[model samples]
Target: MLSQITPCLWFDGQADEAAKFYTSLFKDGKVTRTQYYGEAGKEIHGQEPGSVLTVEFELNGQNFVAMNGGPLFKFNEAISFQIECEDQEELNHYWQKLSDGGDPAKQQCGWLGDKYGVSWQVVPKVLGGMLSDPDTAKSQRAFTALMGMKKIDIAALKTAYEG
Candidate 1:
């Protein structure tokens, strides 16, 4: 059974597009369903009848829902999806794909904002181990090196930790 809790992403009439884009990026991803705005919500939502209202999708086996919630609210950096990559190649792949057309200024410390304003962190799986090492100096070094990078580099972090 699918998990009861799922992240609901807000979009300004781009739920379907965003869902499709995300699904294409992951191996186990797929759009499960899509719903359209109907006549009942016309007075309040102002969305054209039959326009996309919501899209349910899976990315890396995690379920999510994207809704065309209008422009009243905007996506901020407070919420972000974190992809724990197994290696540098995996991390680079996700970083490149997710950051395409995204704001370059927002690219820092493995975090980026996609063109649609959704924030994401493409990180190496070893990042947690490096950042939480029992040795404080090693952990600090790894943390410092990570902060200086746009995309997390596992080799750079290992060098910093060893130094």
Candidate 2:
């Protein structure tokens, strides 16, 4: 059975590379299939015939597709995948891995842009609870603390929330 929805990532010419990177980073990740460009759409796609065109991959058992769609489009903060970590250790691990070779300037409030131009948010699972507290002061403090850091600091957020 085919999945009803699969996020397709567009890459300039690094579909294979990007797929491999993503799969290697997540548990149960793997390249399920590969597709090559053909002469049929040479005029429309302007891609090298017989070259790598698409890669079907899975991350943590979730299906995803990568297409060599040229540089017509790029990933931005408008659409980002959020990783809700259960603990500070998990958050640190993900943040370190995802931020490797990423743009430091774009890193803020738990948001980071990877080397592939993909934006990802590394968040703590307890963050929502703290930010949505009944007390506005507690929530605002948590938000203020969060806005000042690139990688989320659960301990800092906890301090701010408890204050």
Candidate 3:
């Protein structure tokens, strides 16, 4: 069955490359199919005939399409995929992998922009609860700790929450 909603990512010319890279990172990911550009839209797109047009892939069970849509659009921080990490290890692993070739300047509050310019938030699942705790002091401490870091340190967050 097809997913009711799928995210389509736009790339300048790295649709296939990005798809492969992304799928490699997740255990539940795979490149299911790929499509190429034909001469039909030559005048508008100007891409070489038979070049990659789109790659349909699944990441962590969610279907996504990567399209070589030219430089007309770029990914921004306004929209980001948040990875709710189960623990510090999971959070560290993802943060390291995703931010390897990413711009260092974009790191803030567990949010990072990957090499493809796509924004992602690698946060521990406990973060939400800490931030929403009924005790204002605990929540505020957690918020302060969160605001001070780029990639999250689960220990520090917990300490702040327990304070």
Candidate 4:
């Protein structure tokens, strides 16, 4: 069974491509189904009858749908997908893959905008613990260090926390 809520990504006639790219990023990712526009809505949708309309995919076990909804809307940083990695290697891998051809100006504090304008936060699992340490000073230090980084560095955060 799937969850009650699923994220729907809007794209300008790139649903299929986006789905393939996203599925390729995670181990458990796959495209479950693809739907196409029909002649009945030709006037309303303005898309070819056989053209792809939506693609349902899973990324790291999370259900998502990419829709070829035309160019009426665009993606913004208001929403983002956060990938919590187990270690530095895992974090770096995801960060590099997702940020390829992305906007360099938007890369800050582990947040980046992918080529498709989708924002992603590639962070390590340890970040949560460091930022939430019981000791206020340690947590503050970690937070300060985090704000200064583009990609998260687990080692730096640990050093800040221990300080």
Candidate 5:
């Protein structure tokens, strides 16, 4: 029942589907509600009476609400979910799933996208150490290694920082 902490997402007639897809991506998460507009509600965006208006779900212990907002807006790469992974295995799993349908963009550190146009970062915990390393050279190398990856190669990052 956490309030004031949920992400409200806008979808173009795909709120329900997006909710279902997001729930499937994370453990301990699922769609909790799908509310439809009724005849009493004014027709909006040509939505038929009784059409779904909102979808509520949870992912990775975070609550999300999606609305059929009539294509007024969309998700962009500007805002992203950052997953700090423990190791490369976890990073790969998340990278594969999230990038299944979206375009991949290589950035310094860890970042990518899913087919649904959602941005994500599968960062390794070790990255924090590297970025915070006392040695400026190692930190620069770590930054360079992060820049060369689309899906974060933890081993490469580690090697860069260590060497």
Candidate 6:
């Protein structure tokens, strides 16, 4: 059997809603399967008789599972999905969708709550190369530029580090 480890997002009785919202965000992905409480051959769950058990879905080629696992755990900024965009337009599209229930941090980056309190980062790939330059001078310049802004500006970072 093929096996893969996917991020299992825990939601407080809103797994279905979160799954639907996430499926709507990305064009390349869709909801694959969903298991509810009273479905065929389903295990018995307490309190909520016919609640959602798990939601299996994909977003931008990544697989994720959402569970109506009550309020045992919560999402924080400590973990986030980094979306590498080629340009501003792509970034804007992702940013707008991900930021639906989020509060903007500043510049181009922000912390999105998703419908499930999950956070994701919309970043530019160019920012990685600029920040990881072998030359300390270039790296420093990139860091300086990145520190001043919330949403990363790839063009400005390249100009500062390359020049």
Every model's TM-score: 0.96, 0.92, 0.96, 0.96, 0.88, 0.84
Clashing pairs in 3: none
Mind sharing the TM-score for model 2?
0.92
Evaluate model 5: give its TM-score.
Answer: 0.88
Model 2 clash tally, residue pairs: 0
lDDT of 2 by residue, 1-163 (tens): 8546888999999999999988887777899999999899799999988999999998876788999999899888888888888999888887888889988987998999988989999899999999999999999999999989889889989999899
Best candidate, lDDT: 3
- Model 6 CA deviation exceeding 4 Å by range: 1-3, 39-47, 105-115
Predicted structure 4: clash tally: 0
Task: Give the CA lDDT, 0 to 100, for residue 86 in model 2.
Answer: 92
Which regions in candidate 2 have their CA more than 4 angstroms from the true location? 1-3
The global C-alpha lDDT for each of the candidates, from Candidate 1 onward, is 0.93, 0.90, 0.95, 0.92, 0.79, 0.76
RMSD for each model, in Å, please? Answer: 1.5, 1.9, 1.6, 1.4, 2.3, 3.1
Q: Given candidate 1, what's the lDDT at residue 25?
A: 90
In candidate 6, the residue pairs with backbone N, CA or C atoms under 3 Å apart (3 or more residues apart, or in different chains) clash, namely 108-151, 109-150, 109-151
lDDT of 4 by residue, 79-131 (tens): 99999999999999899988998998889989999989999999988888888
Please report, as a residue range, the 10-residue window in candidate 5 with the lowest summed lDDT: 104-113
lDDT tens per residue, model 1, 14-96: 89999999999999999999999999969999999999999999987788999999999999899999999998988989999
lDDT value for candidate 1?
0.93
Model 6 lDDT, residue 18, Cα:
86
lDDT tens readout by residue for model 5, 77-133: 789888888888888877777777777453335677666666778888888889888
Model 3 C-alpha lDDT per residue in residues 37-156, reported as the tens digit of each score: 999979999999999999999989889999999999999999999899999998998999999999898899999999999999999999999999999999999999999999999999
* Model 1 spans with C-alpha error above 4 angstroms: 1-3
lDDT score, candidate 6, position 64: 95
Q: Which window of ten consecutive residues has the lowest lDDT sum in model 4?
A: 1-10
